[model samples]
Target: MPSAYVARVVLREPVVGARTWAGFATMCTGMFIAILDIQIVATSLPTIQSALGIPPDQMSWVQTAYLTPEVLLIPLTGLLTRLITMRWLFVASVSVFTVASCGCAASGSFATLIAWRVLQGASGGTLIPAVFSAVFLLFPDERQGIATTIAGVLAVLAPTTGPVVGGWITETLSWHWLFLINVVPGTLSALGGVWLLTRDQPSGLLRELDLAALSLLAVSLACLEVGLKEAPELGWVTPITLSCLGTSMLTAVLFVRRTLAARHPVVQLTMLADRRFAVGSALSFACGVGLFGSVYLIPVFLGFVRGHSPLEIGKIMLVTGLTQLATAPLAVALERRLDATVLALLGFGLFATGSALSATQSVATDYDGMFWPQIVRGLSIMLCLLAPTRLALGHLPPEQIPDASGLFNLMRNLGGAIGLALVDTVIYGRVSGHATDLAARLASGDGEAARAVGIPQALFAAHAGEPADPATRAFVAPLIERAALAAAIDEAWILIATLTLVVILALPLVRRRAEPTLEKTP
Candidate 1:
């Protein structure tokens, strides 16, 4: 109902044209498969490892390989968009992704599958941000809300449904079908998409690649991502990790200098000079942290501590997707009429509240107990996703949109990388400290510890390391670890809550969109 009213109020004509919808549909299909692939692979990693004889330790690289390039390529989207044009870029990315999917499905070796995944990730990363550009470029302002809302839901829904979808394929068919399933949709998304959006306008004329900048950028992000991923397992200060960190710093500094001096930089660092864009990009980073970090925390908590199956956790997580689906239409409807900054304030506040509430969780917290926080986060994330784009590019000039889009989107991924690292530090670093403290407190038959874990003095005296029943050993160890873990997670949740509240300082940077200055040049 509000969509109609907002359309009427904002537009003199119908905004959702046939071509517009067709273009948007193509984008949605591509993005869905892209996102869904990530989650599916995650759930099916064990099977994949078994199939390819991948070492348990190296199996994580399957994901790391994909994400490193994805993160690297994301910042260079504007350059790519300018180099090949949006039409061809979209087609090529989808095509390569499809081909990579085929390669992964047919892969006979661990190395081969990882190679294909890297290709898939590079291609897929392009489409994820492109979806947003399409929302602004393919549609008019009045209709952007609806388009963005739909696309946002697809992105959010993929994570929610991934475990279920991955579980189903593994149980019913086989893991190969997970990759194979993408072939049809990805093909259509590529071929049909190009044919539908046949028109093109030159955005960037920079024909040459900034090789130095590209190299530094690639190394910097690759190191940063890999370093963060490895930090929890291998101590952060370990030699290899320190080298990665140091290398990332060096390359990052060089990349910034190189890009600043270059005539046609791969990433438009200048875009951040705009006050609104800078603030918006920062907010996007925070949003990325919220989105990816929360997703990481939930599955981890449920799997490691709560002992819930992936399927059950997936069902619990579906509440977020459902809540997002329910609220998206209204958020999109308000996007045009409401000041983006105001909506952002409301979003950050609710998100902070939800994160704070979750911090109070105990070992007993379950699906229903966490339900309201899911709803709060779900509703807030829509605003988080939608508002940053509006705040950043909504006010920029026509020619600045593509570069700004790339920069804006990059912040989100960077946030995820940095946020996950922080989460790990909290869990790995804090849990050990908490465990030591907890052990000391429980040393002399502590009453509170007794009441909390339900272990009597006699059981507490039993050494966990002794030869014991498998069931008893598992139970006792987890009981001790869970106590320490619960405290650590609560502390991490509080940290996340504090971070969300910190977004308020950036709210003032988001000015009202200049309606007349807004251009339709996508």
Candidate 2:
């Protein structure tokens, strides 16, 4: 009995009190800025493209460069934390991120900018899992709710407010400031992390690092990220997309097999065998689909369909961010009192409804039309993040938390990647068909089609009563494309909502947390 109890005991005790909280907050801030950089740069890509004289075709590489390394490095953070203590790992990451930000600001060309972005992303990738792992390592189980709330707020909030922040920065200060803004925050976080964090001795795990597995992981994630990025534009079945995805799959299989057979795997895939963690991971993925999909959707609609500038779009999108801020406390409080599964169900249900509500939007829908759906989604955001987070990482022993956090967060990111691709696929695939159908209807004197094409009734009568002149068709072409885009975006909304709802079906399979039989010894 004593031997069994010894085996179950936490190897490291949770750090307590004010200093640890400050240390945890420092890590969270680092994470926030890292995540914020992604959105800030994303929203202002056009400005950057124009300033750098990058061709439109090549502009997306700026983001793709950052995202690929980010995705690849995220799952490796556990191994990194083991090799270097969390404090040093965070400080090093922040330093690299800060310096890379400077490089980004000084870049004279697209190639230079993308090179710096890759470094920025590689370092930034560790910040998220580091903070999450800190939650479990730094706080006792009872206090984890509040800790997670803090991290969760920033985690969700960065992306929520990123567009607005990016838009404002580009409009007022220029795109350079987007990367420059991280300097002070990143530096301070690093310094504070060094001062406040309790140091843990390294496990001398460096010698055991498996280079082959590392190489495989790098190839798999890089290919997968590039594949997903290009799949939307080039079509999923194209040679480029297929080759990248196929390589990712084949390498991923080898990596998994190698990991499972190894005594000390880089990432702990065996965690999936735990029913609660597995279900929680699935829920996390669904939440990602909604979170990232909506962020991408709203901006595209405002910018393309409504012809809103980035600044104006950001202002309109503030509805979601402000609502999230207002409801955050309520969410944190409920997380403490509510059943994790029940809270997750409620959150997902609201998210699905919110997504579905947005699908009802038309070409003419604007801020007033989008307000309530954003509100509902904002209200549910914290709930979605907090509940599944607790379900996934809450019950795990301290030693396992780092690897578990990496895997759990990886699922969310993967969901986001796949979801965005699907959204793009829907919009790009169906827009032309919608335009053709609308054109035929307009030719048949359909009033609704005329309205969608924005043709005046008198003008529509002229066009429909006779073969339209080239001048008239030319005038109507842009309007037809706009209406078709709006229709396509609506279908994409329904796709994400359905995905979120479908995740709920697996909730029943997760077992409830078993009651504790032994108190954790200090």
Candidate 3:
């Protein structure tokens, strides 16, 4: 028989009062630092690499090590919380994450740093879903919107400000400060969690947890993360990529089947059967494509095509972050009056428009070109986050919220991983072909092509009616590569935009009613 353990897991009534709010805030703080670490390391990787004497080929693993384990651990957090209870789980996660951050800062070599990063990733992964889960568990429906806004703002804000913060820290102090900065926040969050959170004993559900299903879940996600990371460079059909992805799919199937049959599943998979949660998860995935992909794309364009430094890129990228901050109030107000599906459609529609606008970019595009697109996208962020979040978790019972939150958040991360891989594939596969085509046009004395490639029409004019000398070709080669890169990046923007637009179709399936759909386990 299926166990009644799910019903038994709600250890107390929904959290209430000022102390609970403080506890929620502390959880948010821990989550913020954890998310910030990903973006900060991305922005400061070059500096970190030089400091540690890491080879160019190996530097990327610094990030992959962090990301792979984080992905594997996120969904598992639902079960982990049952084993320890939320209060101790939050405290322990924060403490371990802080210690790992310190170890990262103190590391003297590449291997040492990666080891610390793996630990950091494992501990930090739980913080995000834990905060989102708290919003529903700690607040009434009337107040969940405002609370979601607070958590959503911080969630998105961390990534938006990470580049600027990381760049400033590395330039003024040192790359070590990137990790060190997490210490103060982590310490306070850990202490606050212990003091403010309601104490509850674990349900002692470990005996009921399915170890085989747990292993399958971990292996599936780990393999999936690895496959996505390698697919862009190695080609999706290559043996290693195929093996990893195939194994991920196979294990995922077995895991889902095993969990569905288990008396007490490790992580709740039945939540996805609810229409609201299911549709909301899909929308969340789409938002991830836009949110994380744009963050990744903008920095690459600014650094490589525009020849900007990390600080300059960060400053330029501030438009999106600032606009998001300015729009949060309006989004919260609107969430109260509108149906969630309506709000979600509006949010995703505007996001799609913004992404489409960005797809028209040229090599010379800068903050001026990006400003309006950033504003449109910024306007959509909170709308995209708040509504889908409420739709996904709002109707679930307090006990189910934790597991559902983990699954919902997992969809977004998976979307980000896949979106980034596709973006990389587009850039790498197209740049060479685009460069070749532009070179051909230049050779044919096309002034329009000359202008598009950032070469002076006069340069082409000087070589008019004659084969250009090797010197001229060499000079123009770099310009052709730059223009090619810009074109490739634009295509990537369109790909994400299309993805965002496509998910909007599923909104109708979300049902107009907001009542809880699951049979309460008893």
Which prediction has more favorable TM-score, 1 or 3?
3
| Evaluation by lDDT, superior candidate among 1 and 3 | 3
In candidate 2, what residue range of length 10 has the lowest lDDT sum?
A: 4-13
1-522: candidate 2 lDDT, tens digit per residue: 355555544443564889998899899999999999998899999899999999999988999899889888888888888899888999999989999999999999998999999999999998998998998888877788888888988988898788889989988897899999999999999899999998898864787888899899999999998998899889999999999999999999999999999888989999999988999999999988999999999999999999998778888888888888899889988998888899999999999999999998777899999999999998998899998899999888877888898899999999999999999999989999999999999878898888776778786776566877898789989999999999999999999999999999988987877665765566
Model 1 vs. true fold: TM: 0.90
Better of 2 and 3 by TM-score: 2
RMSD vs true structure, all candidates: 5.2, 2.1, 3.7
What lDDT tens digits, residue by residue, belong to model 1 across residues 32-136? 999899888888788989988999999999999888888887877777877787788889999999999999999999989989999999998888877777776
lDDT tens string, model 3, 338-435?
A: 99999999999999999999998888899899999999999999999988898898777777888888899989899899999999999989999999
lDDT of each: 0.81, 0.90, 0.89
TM-score to native of every candidate shown: 0.90, 0.96, 0.95
Q: After superposing candidate 3, which stretches have Cα over 4 Å from the reference?
A: 1-15, 514-522
Clashes of 2: 0
Rate residue 457 of model 2 by lDDT. Answer: 79
Model 2: lDDT to the true structure: 0.90
- In candidate 2, which residue ranges exceed 4 Å CA deviation? 1-15, 456-463, 518-522
